[model samples]
Target: MNRLSVSRLFHLNNRKLFQALIARYSVDTGSKDYIDGLVKDDNVVVFMKGTADQPRCGFSNAVVQILNFHGVNKFSFHNVLEDESLRQGIKDYSNWPTIPQVFIGGEFIGGCDVMLEMHKNGELIEELNKVGIRSVLLDRIEEEEKK
Candidate 1:
């Protein structure tokens, strides 16, 4: 075969091999109902790349920091890196193709960029307030205003 045809054949074979491997290793993710329950079960749920204490990605770390900055220490976090199914499942479930998804009061709250925007605009404070968890930044601002 010509060089171009040989390369094309090789690429096709590689693609087939990759597909077979994926099919063999694919895992069954939790059902949509299960994901719904999990997100709603907690006031704050974060589907990130790693644990809250040790985030695997910068985006995940930013999310953890954002939550901590607001004095939100007691929240639920699922490490997507540990579960391939969860990694894909959450993206599919939220219809948001990104890691480090944040949920508040059982509502889908977008990813790191959205969180940063909310934090800057003080919208995050209001959302937290709705769930009965006050933001510490609000108290700091109030204290400064009183002085």
Candidate 2:
């Protein structure tokens, strides 16, 4: 066979393999429900590239850092890299095509950019207060004033 023919055959096989993986990893119908439970059960949840202790990507790490800076110590997190189905499923669930998705009080807060903006504008503390969690960052400031 000629080089062109062999190249065409290889491309065809690669396309077929890609389709098969897509079919296998497509979001399950119940994935939305699963994600719903996860978000609602936790006041703060992050669907990130890695676990909270060890974020795999810069975006995910930025989110972790922002939350830590705000003194948000207790929050749930899921590493989308661990599950192919979940990686895609979360995007579908949120209708937002990105990793490092954040949820506060079961509401979608958006990705790292949004979180940073909110933190910068002082909106993050208000959001946390609405969910009944005090921001340690703010709490410390208040304590200092009382001294």
Give the best candidate by TM-score: 1
Instruction: Give one digit per residue, the lDDT tens place, for model 2 in 1-147.
Output: 999999999999999999999986674633887789888988999999989999999999999999999888789998999887789888999999999999999999999999999999999999999999888889788989999
Relative to the true structure, candidate 1 has a C-alpha RMSD (angstroms) of: 12.9
- Backbone clash pairs for candidate 1 read none
TM-score of 1: 0.80
How close is every model to the real structure, measured as TM-score? 0.80, 0.76
Model 1, 63-141: lDDT tens digits are: 9999999999999999989888788889889999999999999999989999999999999999999999999998899
What TM-score quantifies how close candidate 2 is to the native fold?
Answer: 0.76
RMSD of each: 12.9, 11.5
Model 2 Cα shift for residue 107 (angstroms): 0.4
